[model samples]
Target: MANDLSLNKEQILDAAEQALKRYGPDKTSVVDVARALQVSHGTLYRHFASKAALREAVTERWLRRSIAEPLAQATGLPQGGSAAERLRLWLDTLIAAKRAHAAEDPELFAMYAAVTMEAAEMIDAHIDGLILQMASIIEDGITAGELRPGRPETIARAIFIATSRFHHPAHAREWNAERTDRDYDSVWELILAGLALPTA
Candidate 1:
């Protein structure tokens, strides 16, 4: 294989994702990724310590791109807008992102699911990021007098737990159900009742 000096971590990850999609995570190897990149396998080792390391990187990257990044953007609510509205937008962006990722590339999604299960730290970190996004929205709501005053982090954690089925990857199968949106709306309404102020 050529000693491709320009091979960076991003290139390795892109190749690794292709390899995972083509061969599945269990069968893919660092050698396979290097082969795909036309580089020496040892070159990849410089970027990722091992095959497992490469997979973990791929999973983390996917989580950020497909989930966290979009939700991060959703936290930017307009001035004087309802925090409840911003919160709903956050959920909608999250749900749409996951559903589209899963539907458009079932193979990649399955690979992501398998690897993520083995990466608890990665999952926890990802959830923490999402929880922070939730807290930001809740904090804005409370500041605007649209929501009850409470610890935003505490309320965000509770809301995240309450709405897990709507966004969590483990519950992906139920996402396509006819009653899924209605079910989520009912859950959201209950959460809003607890958090939002009633208008006279």
Candidate 2:
């Protein structure tokens, strides 16, 4: 019975995600999800108290699949390359994942932004840990003389914020449309230039 209930919950959440993507969060409702899943409203409510709660669950699931999974995979990649190379690869992987997901379901991007604003401290902590892990990699580069000597945490925070600003549609639209990749490459070059060691 427990397993069956869990499966039902998963199905309902999946249905909710599809509905959100199609109708958007503001327009999506429990009735819409129930109709999509061919389940009764009572059954949907059995898994989630309300549409907002279900939306949160859907957004959380999307984050787990889209962001957490890719980060985990990147962490498992070979780490022997130059620190700068590894950092670039890691950032590129994250950016590519975001771009792909946004292309497939732009509504999901809006959902993520909303959830990030209202999510609990635990969620924020997890995000912080991800940032810190990236910073640790940059610190390794600095120690190896592949990057300049400075505060790794600060540098990491700056790069994360800067890259996010450049790639996020909210900010990127202000810049040239045809030159997004150029802008990204330039930003990365500037970051590396600031951090790379001066050859003797």
Candidate 3:
């Protein structure tokens, strides 16, 4: 119930997110968002070119939450913290965030999963963005002399793929299994050991 004249793009996106949460992505539409804001469809379209564009924007916003803040912390690891610690924090935080989303509302999470699949371009960009963030952390580790010499981009992608189960939407349901935390610990330890330089 937002006033049309005062509405902005963020307001539209917020209303759209709520609509998607309530009616789901498949049933939700630009018109619904407009109705929520008490605006005309034309007004909404003035902000977003099309429904698909709006959906992509919303998806980007959702994906950004998992990357933007966490990447900053991962790249800015505290003094005395190893790259392994930063990597572990990144992976663990992502898993927890995904789990929190599901716990908050399984239906909404499911809707997003579906929307994600439909928005292929946005998903590709999201994955690329994650890889770039991971690479930056890996490069930082190398630069700090905490990790062995190697191609950071390759290592970053390997790490991302290695920890896929913890954050991938397809594996969302299995994240809470009793052994999942144990599994993550084992994987993290293995990666840390592999990446660390051998002592003389």
Candidate 4:
């Protein structure tokens, strides 16, 4: 008996993920998801209108829980620390999230590469959210006199672009390379110098 009287989108997404794992992205159908949840197709349709919509929801959910949420939690920014330290924590949190996702869900991580391209709009929003987060820290840095006065968004975007290799899914293969952390540290050194924040 399907006790889905209180079923929600999150529950639908959870079922969809299981279907995806079994069928991969290309083969996973709405029916598969509905079947997994032991619900009718109309029930699933109420949450996600189409397979594409379902994919986008899955992508958005992954980006939120895996990346954006963690970074926000790691640094509730615009706080008391020098911006450099906050940025370090923020960037480290990002790198750690990416690495963990790749390692923990290698199959999904690989499959997501294809879905992400199709979900460009969602990806853009996610990137924008992360940049805004960094911008908050940068704004605080300027106020604290640890960084040069400038547009926070522009600076945040630049830093994000510069450090994309660490967090970008395309670089998952290189994440485990022996030189990865050393390379990341080197980039951090350059970024720190540019920020004019005191390093200890």
Candidate 5:
């Protein structure tokens, strides 16, 4: 149908994301997105029932891009490395993503907050999966004697929360803004110290 050809769901969602990125959730409107995509408001509504629905979709898309896909990619990496090494790489990747997004689009941080509060369960599930992945790496490290013996899931959950909060721009504005190589090195040292086996 010509109507379907006029505005696909992907385009509408993409436009919503761009709008959120540019103006944040509070300022972004369905009409604005429609205008940005050069489509009538009706076209957007045809795909999304309301502005809130569009926002939810946009938030979901953002999370998938920032968190889900990265975790999935990390899963496929060869599993020969020590758990500490894998965890370090994963944390570094996560922190870098937060910092890059913060510097690239401040509004995205705002949008993240807005959507997170609105869709806590969905966001929590995604985070839980990441924690499980981290736990798996920790267990691997323990088996290799690279890390101290302990419950991997508990440790992973603690590390995930601690690292996430520390890197979260919403909570640690100063740290995120001032993150440098030295900062990253310090974080890695702390994480390794907590999990690594003592040197002889």
Candidate 6:
């Protein structure tokens, strides 16, 4: 409700997130966000350029928050575990976090997907981030000699694509099944088996 001229991008994004949650992405407009911030629509545009941009910002923030903490924990895997173990742990943690997000707030999760449909560039960037994170972990594994010599980026993409059913929004319904964990373990073991060097 603070209409101060000093309203910043974070403040606008916070207000826009609230608006999007309340009205869903399709109905939430720049005017709605402005009202939430007690500012004119023009004031909001000064920060976001347009409603689509504002929605993308809000969606991006949400997606980033979902992974930021877990991603750090994943990357900071303890020194004790082998690279294969660490990689599996990191992937499991990410998949769990994504599943929890969808399960905890079905409506908001659906709304986020709706916002994404209108923001192809943002979606692409998000996927790129996921792949990059996977690649970083793969590089760590290869450096530690637990993984075979191969292109980290290529392996990362393969892992991410194979695990899509667990993390991707379109597969949310499938992610809810009780057998999801078992299904993941099977896929993860297969990936690790492929990545690990053959024993003498």
What TM-score do all the candidates reach, one by one? 0.91, 0.78, 0.86, 0.89, 0.78, 0.90
* Model 1: per-residue Cα lDDT over 1-200, one tens digit each: 33577667787788899898889878988899988999887778888888888888988998898789877876864545578888888888888888898898787777677666888888889989999998988888888888999999999999988988977777888889999999999999999999987776
Worst 10 residues of 5 by lDDT: 168-177
At residue 133, candidate 1 shows an lDDT of: 92
lDDT tens readout by residue for model 5, 47-136: 888777887777777777886689757855957666776787788777777777767777767667666778778778868887788888
Which pairs clash (backbone N, Cα, C closer than 3 Å) in model 4? none
The superposed Cα distance between candidate 1 and the true structure at residue 117, in angstroms, equals 2.3
Candidate 6 segments whose C-alpha is farther than 4 A from its true place: none
Return whichever of 1 and 6 wins on TM-score: 1
Task: Give per-candidate clash totals.
Answer: 0, 1, 0, 0, 0, 0
Among residues 3 or more apart in sequence or in different chains, the pairs in candidate 5 whose N, CA or C atoms overlap within 3 Å are none
Error (Å) of candidate 1 at residue 79 is: 3.8
Put down candidate 2 lDDT per residue, 70-134, tens digits, no spaces: 77667657677888888888888877777776666767777766666676664566567667767
Superpose all Cα atoms of candidate 1 onto the true structure and report the RMSD in Å to 1 decimal.
2.0
* Model 4 C-alpha lDDT per residue in residues 28-76, reported as the tens digit of each score: 8998898888888888888888998888888789989888887887669
lDDT for model 1 = 0.84
How much is the lDDT of residue 154 in candidate 6?
Answer: 92
Clashing pairs in 6: none
Off by over 4 Å in 3: 1-6, 49-52
Q: For candidate 3, report its TM-score.
A: 0.86
Q: What clash pairs does model 2 have? A: 148-195
Q: Looking at candidate 3, what is the lDDT of residue 82?
A: 71
Off by over 4 Å in 5: 5-8, 22-24, 35-43, 78-80, 176-188, 198-200
List residue ranges in candidate 4 displaced over 4 A.
1-5, 77-80, 197-200
Q: Which candidate is the best by TM-score?
A: 1
Query: Residue 127, candidate 2: how far off, in angstroms?
Result: 2.7
For each candidate in the order shown, give its overall lDDT on alpha carbons. 0.84, 0.74, 0.80, 0.85, 0.76, 0.80
Candidate 1 ranges with C-alpha deviation above 4 Å: 1-4, 198-200
lDDT of 6: 0.80
